[model samples]
Structure formats: structure tokens, C-alpha cells
Target: MSSLLRIVRFTRSLAPLYTAIIIASVLTSVAALAVPFLIGHATDTVAGALAGETPTGTAVRAVVLIAAAVLLAEIANTVISNVGGWFGDVMSNRMRTILSVRYYDKLLHLPQRWFDSEITGTIVARLNRSITEVTNFMKMMSNSFASMLITTLAVLTISAWYAWPLTVLLLIVFPVYVWLTSLTSVKWQKLEAQKNEQVDIASGRFAEVVGQIRVVKSFVRERGELEDFSRRFRSTDATTRAQSSHWHRMDVIRRAFLNLVFFAIYVIIFVRTVQGAFTLGEMVLLIQLMTMAKAPVESMSWVIDSAQRAIAGSRDYFRVMETPVDPRTAAMMAARPEGSRDGEADGAAGSAAALVRSVPGAPVVAFRGVDFAYEDGEDVLRGIDFELARGEKIALVSESGGGKSTIVNLLLGLYEPSAGSIEVAGHPSAEVPLDQLRSRIGVVFQDASLFSGTIAENIAYGRPEASEQEIVEAARRANADAFIRRFAGGYEQVIGERGLKLSGGQRQRIAVARAMLKDAPVLVLDEATSALDTKAEIQVQKGLDELMAGRTSLIIAHRLSTIAEVDRIITLRDGVIDEIGSPAQLAASGGIYAQLLDLQSSGDTRRLARYDITA
Candidate 1:
């Protein structure tokens, strides 16, 4: 998108202030023009009065009135600027809001692997980066450029009226200043763009190190991390210095050029005075007005420079905007009937795959020949198929990089398949609004994203309307109630950003409690116990057990011991399902499942047998 159009669209959200702001800009410009006119009129009127050889009341009155008028215009300009400033702020805020909304919507549409594992840190950098470009444009439009443009025109007009030859001479000289400014600004803007990229990478690196500070300390890798940071920091520093030098160079050239122009004009004006036409006052006022006009033009260069950077920054923003979201099977579909599709087949098979929708109980989750790949074209999940009967629990087991987590992501609609499909309840996963689909499934990942907030708030995140009793019940079910109650403030205690203040097990328990509070028919636990202690693991397992009852559950466990109790253990290898059966059955079959079990046996086979005691 064109930068101007992007800026306009960005400002569209500030409809309330937009009209008032535009008018204020025009008025500010006109008022600045009036300054020279006021000064010129006042100077000429006094000159004429003195020429008449009398201290006339009319001259005195005119001078006072003109002075008063100039004062009034100055006052009005300042007031209008403040009002315009408020509107500028409104526009800047709305632009940021629009950017944020677009960013979040893109996040929803984006395939998971495109971000690799650095998604969270990238997300943090995005949020942390300054919106200086947008804000600068708004401020310049209202406070700087609008009025300055008017003042420039006004000064030139008056200068020509007083002395056309000088005005024309200065006008010829002006474009050189403008051309030089433009050249340097483009170079500076490119440097700024590079600096912006460095800042993002640096900021992302900072967040990454901070997130893994514990590991850094444990491994004594602080020096390594700091050195890595120093490399990026030096790059940022070089770009910043380059940008600063460009502007400084432009300033020095403009100042020297202005001095040369002013000297030429003064020498010419002095000759005119010696030849006996130009007065002392005219030359004095001419110099002052000419200098005043140059000031805005000088500042105008930086304004243009910032405007260029804003345009460049938006390339990243617009690149995100250009990508397409997943296509839906249908624009709309009614809820699927209650009871199994096997009983009646849901929604007449809305395509090859349809989501089940029932009035009561939980949503059924299913994947049909779902194939997916990353942006790099490396396929992660091959054409695989399965159905999670309503309220049935399924645990996913696989060696590392077996696309186990990819399955959970597909079920959650984070990624649509390269071929095949995913269905929720009875509607195609792509067919249902993703937010609505996600609303029906509560997910808890190994590193559960916990925002800085209270335990109660985080637990009830998806279900903001959940009652206090419901929240407490969820905490109790997640095996978090005991530890939570022991805390001084119970549920009111803050979790801190990403639950950094809490233990890994504590965060995991809180995540489980959050999913439980959601009360969705579909629940996901991706390595839910990976971060827990033996005691905490057992406690969390009890909570998971209670939470999974009568819910369609999908679990991804790194340790084989974790999934031994699930209703069905589906083993994945190289993106395809190798086996699907109860743990004991899989072990007896003596395939990948038995091999995995031997690696991480916790002697909990009876406990594993609880969720799926194969009849």
C-alpha cells in the first residue's frame, strides 16, 4: 500500500477529531502567514506616518491596533496548536490501535512454523517497538508542516511585494537547500530502516535472554549472551550514528548556504540603499523576515525525513496485511444435530469434512487426511486421519520432531492443512470462526503463555464471565487449590508476567486451572506435566484426570509415563500415525510405543490404565 494511503487508513479510526484537526491545520498555516503581513503593514504604516513629518493620532492608533492584532494572532495560534495537538494524539493512538488489531488478526491467520520457536519473543519485540513514525507524522501534520508551508508561502509573497528581485533570487537558492535535504534524508531514512531492524532483533534477543536467564546463569553463558548482545548493540550504534551524521551534515550545508544567500541579499540591498531607494527599516525587516522563513524550511527537512521512515516502517506492516487467510468451506452453516454422526451423520457432510455441532455436552474434534507444511515447504504433518468422539480422551505420543504438537495446533485451527481438513463438532475447522472454535477448546502448552495478572484473572481468561464459585471449583479440580489457598491472598495473588514469579509447576497448575475454568468440551494438554515436580506432577495429574472426564481431550506428552492413562495413545513417526491403541496394547504390540515406554517408565502402568482400561 502507498504510505499516504496507509496513513489515511490509519487515521480513519479518529473520525471524531479528523475534521477538526484538518481545519486547525489550515488555520494554523493561515495564522503564521498573517505574522509577516502584520509586521510588514506595521513597518510600512509607521514609515509613511514619519514621512508625513507629523506624530499623527491615526498612525499611533494603527500601530497599536496592528500590535494588538499580532498579539491576538500569536495567542490564537498557540491555542489552536494545543487543540490540534490533542487531535494529533487521538490520531496517533488510533493508528496504533489499528496496527495492533491487524497484527493480532494476522497472528491468528499465520501458520505456526512460520515463526519457528521464536514467536513469543518476536511478539514481545513487536509490542515493545516505538510507534514514533506514526506519532511524528501526526504531530508534524498538525504542529509543524501545515503552518510552516503557509508561513513559507506568506513570507515569499510579502518579500516579492517589498522587493521582487530579492524574492526571486532567494526562491532560486531555496531548491538547492531542498534538493540537498532530500538527498541526505533518503540516505538517513535507509539507515533508520536498518536501525529499526537491528532494534527489533536486539530487542527480541534481549527478551530471549531474559526469558532464559535461569539457563544462562546455570550454564555460565552470561558472558556469551552479553557478547552476542554487544554485537547487535554495536550494529544499532553504527546505524544510529550514521543517521545522526547525515542530519548533521545536512544542517551544516544548509546553514552555510543560508549564510551565503543572506550575504548576497544584504550586499544587493545595501547597494540599493546607497543608490537611494531602499530604506534602513525595510532592509532590517527584510533580513528578519527572510531568516524567519528559512527556519521552517530547515525544520521541514527533518519532518520529511521522518515521513520517509514512517513509510518504510509500514512495509513490514503491509506485508503482513497482504497475505491471505484460510478459505472456508461455506460462508455459513447451522449447528449440527445432537448425538453422533454415526447415529445420523452430521450436517450432510458439508464437504468431505464437517464439524459436529450439538446443543448439549462438548464439541467433537476430528482430523481428516490433514496434511500441513511450513513456509519453507517442509511438510510437518502428512495426510493423517482420526476422530475424537465427544468426551473421549486421546493422548498423542511420539519421538521428538514427530509432529505431535502440530496435531494439537491443527485441532486448535492455528494451521490449516496443505491438503485434507479439520472439523470441529460438525463444521469444517476453517468454516467456523477461529475465535469461536478456540472458545470451545481450552489449551495448556508446556510453556503456557501467562500474562502479568492475578491468578484468578489468568484462570478465568477465556471465560471472563465465569463465576467466583466456578473459578474456585476449577482451581480445586486442577489440584491448584491447596497451593493457592496457602498463598496469603489465595486467588487474588498476582501471577506476574509470564508467571515469572511462580514456579514452573505452579504455572502449569494455573494453566490447567485456566483450561478447567473454560469448561470447554474440547481440552488440550501439551506436555502439561513436563515442568512439574514429582509431587506437583501427581497433583496436576489428579487435576488433569478430573478435567478430562467427559471432555474430548488431546494430550501431547514428551515422557511416555505421562500418557499411559489416556483413553487412546496415538503414536506418530515422521508426520504419520504409526499406531493407535491403549498403552498396554501398544506395548504388547511391541512397536514405537513399547520402545518409548522402556525409555521413560515410572512404574505407573496401573495409573496409566485408569483413563483407558481396555475392555
Candidate 2:
């Protein structure tokens, strides 16, 4: 969509404020023009007195009136500008809020692959620029452009009253100014685009270095990283200088022609005054009016440049808004009943709450003849068929890239199978509303992704309306209550970003508590304790047991011992199920599971069963 249209639509949302700003803008413009006219009248009165045609008293009264008019005009302009500035600030704040919410919603629904390919800092840079553009565009429309338009019209009309020929001459000059600016602005716009690209690159570089500071330090690569950053900085600096240099050259050309036009108007006025075609008062008035018109004319270049930047930034904003969200999630959103909060399914977290309350019992999860692949890639999972009966627990074991996590992702609807189908609670997974589907399942990942908030807040993430009592109970069940209480603030203790202030075990316990609070019918634990030490692992395992108990559980583990107690184990090879049996049964069969166990156990099944082994 066009940037102006987007800005106008945003303004319409807060019409009363913009309306007041518009009224103020017009008044300010009129008052601004009136000052010049008062000055011209004062000059004419003094000239008449000097020529002995007007009395000194009359000139003094004119000077007093001019002073009063100047004071009033300046006061009106100040008050109106203050009001317009307030409106601009309010509009800017609202636009930022609305755009941020939309961007967040888009991020939530975007495919994981998009994130894999895009840098977080680049997205942040785009959002920042886009929001600034939107706000500035509103300010321009309400104040700067409005004032210029009104003053231009008033100046031309008053000029015509003095001399129609001069008005005609101005009309001819104005379009040429606009046309030349438009032509020159195209190059500046291209430079602006390049400058924006450099900003994205520089932002990405900074984000990467900061995000991986530990890695850089550990590898003693600080110098190399700094050198890379220097390169990016230099490139960005060069682009900025190039853009500034081009703009300077264009400004000189524009100002030269504008000044020449102003001089030509002065010569015409002086000649007309000498020819007796215009009086001294008319000459003074025309000159002042022409001066008023000069400002708007000269400002045309600024208007074009700002508009172009806003247009470019708005296009970036819309690109995210227009990106396609996952179809299942979209369907759930569309199916929201009337009065649904934010048009989200159920309400804020209502889907999960309702799902758990309605059915506390386990829900069956099934995958039949499922074949999957990444976009433009070969199959990662083929002819996969499995079912976790209600309240049953199953383990998945395979090589690093052996479609183990792919299975979990497919069941969670993070990816669609190339062929076949998935079912939950006896309904086609694709047909089930995403809200209902997700709310019925809970998961813990290899890395516990935690937000920056209080401990209680993180625990209640899945169910925001969960009470303090419920949150405490869930934490206790997950073995997180002890550490939480150890902190000075207890439940209110702030956890830093991604729970970095907490250890691996602490973070995992919090994640388990979150899942428990959700009370989902099915549980999937993906390498939940893989990163912890023995002592931490034991603690986290207790929490896992509480979460998985009585739920249809799907467990994927790199450490075979972690899943030793599961009712059944499924082994995958080359994207297909190779074997399915109990751990003891697999050991007896002497297959892939047995081989993995031997690799870890030094050839004794008894010792291997107790020893941690890669699967």
C-alpha cells in the first residue's frame, strides 16, 4: 500500500486528535502570514509619514498596532504548535504500539525457517525505522506540510491582489521547483535505500557479536571479531558520507535556482514601482507576500525526501504484515467467536485453560504413513507410523539428524508432512483448531526458553490466569519451589533474559513447572535433561516424572538411560522406523539399540543399562 494511505488510515483511527492538530495548523499558518502583512503595513505607514502625507501620530498608532498583532500572532503560533506537537506525540505512541503488536503477532505465526534465515537485529532495525517513518509522516501531514500549503495559498492570493502578473510568474516558477526536486530526489532515494541496507548489516554485526560474546572470548577471537566489526563500520560510514555528499550537491542546485527566482521577483517589483504601476504600500505588501511563498517553495525538496523515506519504510512494515501465517493457526484465529479477546481463539490463554478443564484425561497422539521434508529438500521422515495410546509413554531414539525431532515437530504442527496424516484426540491434526491442538499438549525442549520476568510469571506463562496458589503448587510439583524460595523475592524474584541468571537445572525446572501449570493432556519431552550434570539431571528428572505421569508421553532423548523406563522404545534408521520394543527387548534383539548400548557400556548389557549412553 502507498505510505500516504497508510498514514491517513492511522490518522483516521485517532480522528479527534488529528482534527484538532489540523485546525491548529491552519490557524498557525494564517497567523504566521499575518505577521508579515503587519510588518508591511507598518512600513507603509512610516513611509507616508516621512513623505508628509500621513501624520506622525498615525504612524505611531500603526507601529503600536503592528506590535500588538506581532505579539498575538507569535502567541497563537506557539500555542498551536504546542498542541500539534502533543497530537504528534500521541499519534506516534499509538502507532508504535499498534505496529509492535502486529509485528509480534507475525513473529509468533511465522515459520521457523524464516527465523533460521533472518537475523533478529535486522528485523529490529526494520521495525525501528518503519515506526519512526510512520510517526514523522503524521507530524509532517499535521504540521509542516499543512502550514506550507496554507501559507502558499494565502501568499499567492494576496500577491494576485497586488499584481496579477507577479502571481502568474510565481505559479510558473513553483512547478519547475517541484519538478526539479522530484527528479533529483530519485537519486537521493536510491542512496537512502543503500544507507538503510548498511544499517541493517551493521546492526546484525553488533547483535551477533554481543549474542555470542562468550564464544568469541572462549575462542580468543576478540581481535578477529573486532576487525570484522570495523569493516562493517567503515562500510556503513562510507555509505552515509556518499548519501550526505549527494544530498549536499542537490541542495546547492535547488537553493541556487530558488534564490535566482526570488531575485527575479524583486527586480519585477522594483521596475513596477518605478513605472508607477504599483504604490509603495502595494510594493511592500507584494514583497512580504513573496517572501512568505519562498519558504514553502524552498521546502519542497525536504518534503519529497521525507515522503520517499516514509514510503520506503512503510513498504518494509507491510512486508511482514503481508507474510503468510501458518494455515492451521490462521484457521483457529478466523474461527474465534464474536467478542473473543483480540480475535484470538477463546481469549488470552483461554484455549489451554478450556482444553485442560474440559478433559483432564490423556489424549491419544497418532502419526500414520507420515513422510516429511524441508522445503526443496529430500525426505527427513518417511512412512512413519506410530500411536501413543492414552496414558502410554514411548521413547524415540535415533542418530543426530535421524528425524527424531522432526517427528515431535510434526506432531506439534510446527511442520506439515509431505504425505499422510496426523491425528490427536481422534481428529485430523490439520482440521483441529491450532488453539485446541496446542493447548492439549505440553513440551520441554533441550534449551529451556524463558522470558525476562518474575519466577511466578514464567511459571504461569501457559496459563496467565493461574492463581498464585496454582503457580506454587505447580512449582512444588516440578521441584522448583525450593530454589525459588531461596531467592530474596521468592515468587516475585526477577529472572534475567532467557533465564540466564538461573542454571540449566533451574531453568528446566521452571519450564517443567510451566508445562505442569498448563495441565495439558499430552506431554513431549525433547532432550529435557541433556545439558545438566548428574546431580542437576536427577533433580530435573523428578520434575519430568511429575509432568509425564498419566499423560500420553512422547520422549526423545540423546541419553538412552533417560528413557530406560519408558514402556516402549522406537528406533529410526534412514528416515524409517527400524525397530520398536522395550529397552530389554531391544537389547536382546542385538540391533541398533543394542549396538548403541554396547558403544556406551563396553559390551555388558547390565552395566550398559545403568550407564548413560548415546542413542
What lDDT tens digits, residue by residue, belong to model 1 across residues 172-251?
Answer: 76788877777775687678778777777777888888878888899999998888878877988878887888788878
Q: Write the per-residue lDDT of candidate 2 for residues 1-615, one digit (tens) a residue.
A: 266676556435566767777787898888888887787777878888999989999889888988898899999999988888788777667666656665666677676667767888888888888778876876776667777888888888888887777788789779988877777566766777777777777787778878777788999999987887677667767767877787778778878888887888899999999999877777877887888788788777777777888887877877776676666665455443322222112122323222313323424877889999988799999999987888888988877678888998888888888999998887778777577788889999988999999999999999999999999999999999999999999999999888888999999999999999999989999888888888888899999998988887999866767667888899988899999999899988888788877777675544433322443
TM-score on alpha carbons, each prediction: 0.82, 0.91
* Candidate 2 Cα errors over 4 Å, as ranges: 331-363, 603-615
Evaluated at residue 574, the lDDT of candidate 2 is 87
The lDDT of each candidate is 0.72, 0.79
Worst 10 residues of 1 by lDDT: 338-347
**Which pairs, if any, clash in model 2?**
none
Mark the regions of model 1 whose C-alpha exceeds 4 Å error after superposition. Answer: 1-5, 15-22, 25-52, 56-70, 89-109, 117-130, 240-257, 273-285, 327-363, 557-566, 594-615
Clashing pairs in model 1?
Answer: 341-345, 354-426, 355-425, 355-426, 355-427, 356-425, 356-426, 564-608
